[model samples]
Structures are given as structure tokens and as C-alpha cells.
Target chain A: MLSPILEFFSSDPKDKKLKKAVEHIIGQKPSNIMLYRLAFMHSSVSKETVAKGYKESNERLEFLGDSVLGMITAEYLFKKFPFKDEGFLTEIRSRMVSRESLNGVARKIGLDKLVEYDGNRRTVLARTSMYGDALEALIGAIYLDKGFQFTRKFIVKSILTQHFDIDTVVSNNPNFKSLVIEWAQREGKQIRFDISEEGAKHNKEFTATIYVDDDSFAVGQGYSKKKAEQTAAMKACEKLEIS
Target chain B: MLSPILEFFSSDPKDKKLKKAVEHIIGQKPSNIMLYRLAFMHSSVSKETVAKGYKESNERLEFLGDSVLGMITAEYLFKKFPFKDEGFLTEIRSRMVSRESLNGVARKIGLDKLVEYDGNRRTVLARTSMYGDALEALIGAIYLDKGFQFTRKFIVKSILTQHFDIDTVVSNNPNFKSLVIEWAQREGKQIRFDISEEGAKHNKEFTATIYVDDDSFAVGQGYSKKKAEQTAAMKACEKLEIS
Candidate 1:
């Protein structure tokens, strides 16, 4: 049933390599070669195709895959932790799908070898987690090629089960923002965070200052606002002895 | 096959009303009546069941449904606007799934009549978008009960094409943030926004101040930081005359 489609991709050596890599990673022969090709085509390598104000790269696929990943993960956690509340489920899901986690998983699954991008370390794309983004795009490709049910099974059986241990993820979730909020709610204290972005667009940094009961306690900085806020919250938690 | 399930729900008058209402809105009989019932159970009314420090309400389903809605909408927009970039697709999707839009759609579908909640205007839930939240939860219920394809068809056919006009939605999208960012990118200018939250949690408002080249250009306020930023961006656009 699949020999004809397999032969189409195997005709060329380069296509054979992609087909083999994708098949090895996703555990299935890709029906659509174009989608799999596009999934790995990072924006850094496609800067010229900006006629529509956006590069013809994997970004759109990333957006779609991100949502698919979220839904699948949410449902997984929702069912797996039936008695657990939304907060706990959300934390675990976030841990499982964090950029760091995705990048790690993508590298472990050899996606970094398939991802096409500018290799220069100074490039903004190189600095960011393009591998993770590629992984998401690949998932999007799988979804579009094989439909939602197949994608869900692949994600659950292949990605989640193979790559992540729920117990470990739950214990390792570094969500200080959620922690601080929970603490504030318990202590009946007012908590807020003020985030400011600075530096150039390529090297933008976010500084988050956390306040409790209108008093600034700690400040932290990171590449993103969420990370900065988490750092700030972690510091606040430490200061308030909220372990 | 469905008669047995229909008979199961039709036994109770209230359940029958709910069954009829949900069937009317979704254009299908719900197999899982419990999921549909849980979809309309607002947090305000479920505060008593806080064993896990979170109320047993539609929130978890809402979270699940939000991702499902996002993925469906993203795919829909991606396929619909083949020539448009991710930014345009994102803006349109945001417009389509905005709190105001969801609330309007839910009311139009008569979900307001079925949704169970405290009707007191003074309650925070009443002031906020519980209707929109319920709509999302309902989508979650549909996805869980009938699966993704059915939910996607229902959304596209019953909700998107029925309640929303694509052309009008595209033309009327209030995305001043995108406009200002585009202008800044074109003119090689620096533009940034600082958002601050004020007042109590229940009545909190976000004030977004737009800055161009380190100088504050304009400020706007709204219930959400995104809205406030959009308002500020609109004012900045008016002053800069980019449009």
C-alpha cells in the first residue's frame, strides 16, 4: 500500500535522507514530502521570501503545531491526573512543552540534524530554540498529513511516552510564578509583577520586579517576560520562606 | 443507536431542556450529557467543591477547549488565507476568538440561557466574561463527546460561517498593535509599550503607555493589557499618521 509513495521520495538521494530521517523520528512514512520539507525550512534560510511580510518558513506550522501540542498535552494530563486540579495539570503540561524541554527532546530525537537554518552562532535564530520550533513544525506537518487522531497517537505514544516521565516532569516544573500566586492567595496578600523590556529587538531582555502588598521585594531578568517573572517570583518565594 | 442516549437524557425535564438547547446550538445530539452539563457549571456556583483548592467548574474544560479552539481556528485561517502571512492570520484569528466576539456568539446561540451562574451584577464573574468561558467549555465538551473533526465542523459551519462574516471580521479587526508595529518596522523607529495593572483584582484595569524613541506618546486603559496596548497603539498611530 505504501510502496509507491515510498518510491517517490526515494528516487533522489537527498529526498531519501529526509524520508528516512522523518520516518525514523516520527515512526511513519510521511505522505506529504512538501510539508515535511517546509517543516524544517527555518526562517533564517528563507529570508528572501518575505513578499507577504512574513518569511515562508516553519513559523506558521510552529503556531499550528504549538496549539495541537497544547490540546493533546492538556487532554493527556486531564485524563492522566483525573483527581488533580487545573493548576497542577497546567504546570505539568507547561513543563512537558517548555522551550527547553522541546529543544532537549528535539535534539534527543535527532531533529537538530534535520533542521535547516543559518549555522552562525551570532544569528538571532541560532540564539533562540529553532530546534524546538522545528519539532513543533514537524508535529504540525504530521497533523496535516495524517489528521488529528494519528497525530495524537503519535504524540502520546511516540513523544510523550518516549521522551517524558510525568512524575519527573511534575517534580521538576520550575513554575515559580504559579507557586508565588498560590502562596499569595493562601496568605491573603496582594501580589503583582511589573515587567519592562529593554535592549535591541534581537537581544531584547525583560526585567521583572515582583511586589507583595505594594512592596517591591525582588527583581530578575531573562530573555523573555515569563522567564523574568518566574525568576522574580522564585526570589520572592525564597524571601518570604514560601517553600 | 442515539435513541438510547437521547432517552437517557430526555428522562429528566431539566436535562431534556439542556439536551434540546445544546442540540439546537451544536446541530447534533450530545452522547456525553455529563460533559455538557459540566460545561455550563460556572465557578461562582461551584465554589463549595474546592477540595483541591480549585473549584469544580468549567475551568478545566475551558482550558482544554481554548487550545482546541485555537488549533481549529489556526488551521482554518491558515487554509482560508493561503496568500496571507502568519501575522494577518493571527490578527484575524484573534478577532474571531476574542472575549467580546465569543461572548457575542454565545449569547446569539442562546448559551446565556443555559449557562448556570450567579446573576448578580456585583459579582466578579458577572462582570467578567463567564459566557465566553462557557462557550469555550462547551466547545471542549463537544470535542470530548464527538471528537475533534466533529467539533471542527460544528465550529466552522454552525459558529464561524453562521455567527461571523469573514470579510467583515477581517475588515473590522481592531489590531492597532500590529499596525503600529508595522509602521515602526517600516520607518526604522523604536516603539515599545509599558503596561501597569491597578485597582483590586476584581476591578483591576490595565494602563498601557506607548513610547516612541524613549518618549511616551500616548496611554490607554482597558480591562486587559492587550486591549489597553491596542488602544494606546491606535492613539500613537493617529498621532504618527501612519495609516
Candidate 2:
């Protein structure tokens, strides 16, 4: 029923195909098809408009969607763990919305197929983060086409429940060092961690500085070497905008 | 009429005053008066519950409100400047929600009087940022009490429009160096900038590192000394979570 209605909205075969794909992914028909169309338009393929420095791309939508996603995740975690402190909630939210997590979600939902980008561009442009970014843009499109309530329901019901196992994510302890190493290996980048200690033996503090491809990325400090390394890895992941 | 109704809802004089104040500030009566009371709870005056680690305070609400405010600001900027790129929108939004800006808004709306905190504690705790934080917590409470649409309208109509002048914010050029210096003075922290230049004189690049209170805060790079310092100041501002 939804497919036929979507098909009736657009006679163009390409538009019909896009509408069907969107409906299939989001479990509903988009009110404004153009917003979803714009959401899928990566900057690589986006053409500059009449105004100089302005181009029709998903970047703006991605910006908006990022905030929307953050709010929803924050609220969900706030209610889910009633007794948890802000630090714990913040940590969990970051893990959930991490680049690796979003990329996995995007792939699982078959969003990679809908993303339109320049095929001839550098191979690195087709990296995993692109899928995650497109997922965010798609969320922005949903938010605009429908209001916040509908978008929140869609994200909570269709996206979070469908793609993410909340219990598993909450229970599993994240090892940032391992996560960063895995990312480095996949991206074929050289990653190194340097540690230094200071203060007395009884109260020594370790500082870890992370370097990617020989350029310093970020640094973190902890009481133990492992803790310091983990902190550094976490910071590096944030700085690299990976995981 | 509203005051008499609020008095009728609460027999306690303190509760009546609080309700009247909240109503006056937000332009509406709150459905859950307890939420508003929780929003004003400062950690300095907060008592831990029987749950041990869990405390009744506004920190959790602050965390939630921060995201709600972020999304509302992002959407507001997204719609207001359709032609502006994401970067521009981000900068302006940050400026609007900056510690200094929010503090000013909180004071303008007389939120400082409503914030509950330990009066005998360190004078720093009663500084400008507390009002800003309380403002955010109030926003979070409003979100939880009235839902997103009502909160959005309140933020736009009562808060944003009444407090912020959008045109002045957009037109003014931000000087990060000055901003950071002012913050350092206010916080009574020792601030220093170290710079290094490399490459040919014709195409030299400058790197600036900012240290606050004798600790390295952040670093930035640019084509000139002033630009490098400005960039460093901007990064330091973000690291310190100040304007």
C-alpha cells in the first residue's frame, strides 16, 4: 500500500526507486521526497549552487542530525539508567554513537547502497565513516520531513531497537586501545603510544601521548600505564573522529 | 489569577514563591512542580539518596538539558540561515551557547536568585557559570515536563528571542585571544602563549601552544603568529569549556 502510494507521488523511475528504497529502510513514506534526496547527496557529487561557496550537500543535514541523535540518545540513557551519574551516561552515549558503531548500524540497515557519492574519487572517500555520516544525514531528513516526535519514534523504534542491542552495549567493557588498533589496521595507518611517568613512586602519574602517522594526535593522563594508554587511545579516537 | 492558582496548588509559602517565579520566568505554569524544584538543586547543596551513589541534584538534568538546548539551537540556526554552511552555523551556535553568553542570559532572566547552592562554600561555585548551568537544567526540566514541542516554543519565544539578539551575534567578529584573556583574568589563572615558526620565510607556518595555570591546555597552527595565537586561544577556550 505504501509502495504504490509512493510510486504515485513520483512518475520518474529514479524518484520512484529512491522513494521505495527510503520507505523500505525507514518503514514509512517520506512526506517531502526532496529532503531524503538531498540527504543522500554526498559532497563529492554535490554541485555548487548559484551562490559561491554554497553547495547542495548533506553536510548541513548531517550537522542537524548529529544534535538530534545526541539528544535522543541522552534522553534514552537518562531514563534507562535512573541511578547512573552524568559521566557514566556520557561515556555510554559516546560509545553508542561512535563512528564504528554508527558505521556498523548503517551497513546492517543497507544504507550504503542508498548513499550517492563520486565513484571516481579517492578510495579513502569510500571509507566506513561515510556510511555513518549518511546515516546521520538520513536522520536529519526524517527530522525535517516529519516533526521531532515522529523522528524520535523512528529513531527509537526503527533505528536503535532494530540495529543496536542496548543490553549488550551496556554490559560490554570497551577497550579503547584495542579499538584504536583495529581502526588503525583497517585504515592502514601507523599508530603509536608514548608514555611518561612523573611524581613519587607512591603516587606516580602516567601520561600517554598518541601519534598517528608520526603526528601527535592527543594525550591523556592516568595513575597507571594501562589506564593512561586507554585514555590516550580514547582521545585519539575522538580526535581522529573514527571511534 | 496565575499567582492565586499557584498559591492554591501549594500550601507552603516557599513552594508558592517558587511556582510563581517559575511561571513568571517561563511564561507558563509547570505540570510537575517537583521537576522544576529538582532543576534548581545544586550539587553543593545536594544530599545523596539511600541508593548510595545516586544523589538528588541537577547534574543529571544538566546533562540532558545540554543536549536539548543543542538540538534546539542547531535547528534554529539551520532554518534561519538556509544559505550558510554548517561551519558558520556551528560557530554562531557555539557563540550563543557559550559559557559567557548563557551566564549573561541567566542573569538577565534573574535565574541567579532561583539557583540553590551552598552559600558558605567557595566563592567560585557561585560564579557566573553556575547560573548558566542552572539555566540549562531548567531547560531540561521544561523538556521532561512539557515535552519537546512545548519546550521548543518556550526556548524560542521566551528565552532566545527575549535574551539573544541574533543580528548582533552574527555581525560581531569574535576575538578568541581577547575572550580567553578575559576568562583567565576572571578565573585568576596564569595564562601564557608559546609560538614556533617553521619552513621558508615566504611560506612559514606558525604553531602556538597555550598554557593555563602552568599546564598545557591546547595547541593550534596557522600561517602567522597572530593567527596561530588566535587559533590556540580558540582551542584553549574549548578545552577549558569557556567562551
Q: Which stretches of candidate 2 lie over 4 Å from their true place?
A: A1-10, A174-243, B1-10, B175-243
Best model number under DockQ: 2
What lDDT score is found at residue A43 in candidate 2? Answer: 69
Best by lDDT: 2
Q: Cα miss at A119, model 1 (Å)? A: 2.8
Where is model 1 more than 4 Å wrong at Cα? A1-10, A47-54, A121-124, A173-243, B1-10, B47-54, B120-123, B173-243
Q: Score candidate 1 by lDDT.
A: 0.79
True-contact fraction per candidate equals 0.52, 0.81
Estimate, for each residue in A168-240, the C-alpha lDDT of model 1 and write its tens digit. Answer: 8777756678889898898698988999986555545578998889877679765578777877886676555
Backbone clashes in model 2, listed as residue pairs = none
Task: Give the alpha carbon lDDT tens digit for every residue of A1-243 in model 2.
Answer: 245457457678888889899999878887788788888887667765667656778889999998999999999989998887675687789889988888888888888888898786549476648888889999999999888988899889877777778888888767788889888898799988999996555546588998889977778765579877877887776655555
For each candidate, the alpha-carbon lDDT, in order, equals 0.79, 0.82
iRMSD values, candidates in order: 5.0, 1.6
The per-residue C-alpha lDDT of model 2 at residue B111 equals 88
